[model samples]
Target: MTKELLLAAFIISVGLCVAGAGTHFYQWRLRQQAMLRYDGATVFASMGNLVMSFFCGPYIMLQMGWSQEGGASVNMGSALLSALVAFGWAFLTGLLIVGLYVAVRS
Candidate 1:
């Protein structure tokens, strides 16, 4: 991989992470305002979602064959498909983590 590719990946990954973190923080703040109990499950679910999104987005891009050139060589259709897959994966991963936590707590 060229420096360009590496830089692109890094920028994409960091952007995703920051966005995810911001969303998590907003949710937490909302919960706090509601006087809801802040527990491990809440933290785990939020963090899980962020992590899933952060990694999966770029992964989808890569899996779709997106390269440094950013052109037809990399199938645009495949990129969309990979993005959809990543979306599902991220949602399911968050749900799965919550389920496991509930099971263990019970």
Candidate 2:
């Protein structure tokens, strides 16, 4: 592949990895907060977090317009937006998984 194509792929790959890691980190933070009120279900949460982070990555990248970036910026605003969206997606997915679990268990 040409250098430019390789460079573009590298940037987008880095961005997606960062977004996934950010989401996973957010999940850890949520677990910490949840621990304050209640305990247990760590395994479930971890599994759900993994699934959410893996599945939500593409959506997050699309949200960041990684494909359509036309050479996107490495600026703070873009980075922040990407992280924010990733965290939000992860959080929402976690909630959904928990809710489903509760509903089924009841």
Candidate 3:
């Protein structure tokens, strides 16, 4: 891939991770303020947040084998690595955001 293409991909992947982290933070904060209470709308919104955060990864890597003779095949190793990287990115982002919020509130 060209340098530009790689750079674009990196930006898109990181953006998705950031968005997921933000949504996860929103959901967590909402629930925390509610004191473990769950409303219907909140439940649905939280589920959406979970899905968005869960799938924030290098999904294009999973499609690398799509053009093969057989149907789309996934490389387990790549999938696992992508997941780990995405999770780490989101986790770090979340921690940074929460830490800053706490620091500012103190």
TM-score: which candidate is best? 3
Q: What is the C-alpha lDDT of each candidate?
A: 0.49, 0.53, 0.49
Superposed by TM-score, candidate 2 places the C-alpha of residue 90 at a distance from the truth, in angstroms, of: 1.7
lDDT of 2 by residue, 1-106 (tens): 6997665554545545555565556558676311112223797866765655455564454455333444555556666676667555544554554556679999
Give model 1's TM-score versus the native structure.
Answer: 0.32
Models ranked on TM-score = 3, 2, 1
Instruction: Report the C-alpha lDDT of model 1 over 44-96, residue by residue, as the tens digit.
Output: 87665555444344343334434433454766676677666644544544445
Query: Model 1 Cα RMSD, Å?
Result: 15.1
Q: What is the model-wide C-alpha lDDT for candidate 3?
A: 0.49
The 10 consecutive residues of candidate 1 with the worst lDDT sum are 31-40
Note the residue pairs that clash in candidate 1.
none
How far in Å is the alpha carbon of 66 misplaced in model 2?
A: 9.0
Question: Which prediction has more favorable TM-score, 2 or 3?
Answer: 3
Task: Give the range of the ten consecutive residues with the poorest summed lDDT in model 3.
Answer: 58-67
Candidate 2 clashing pairs, residues 3+ apart or interchain: none
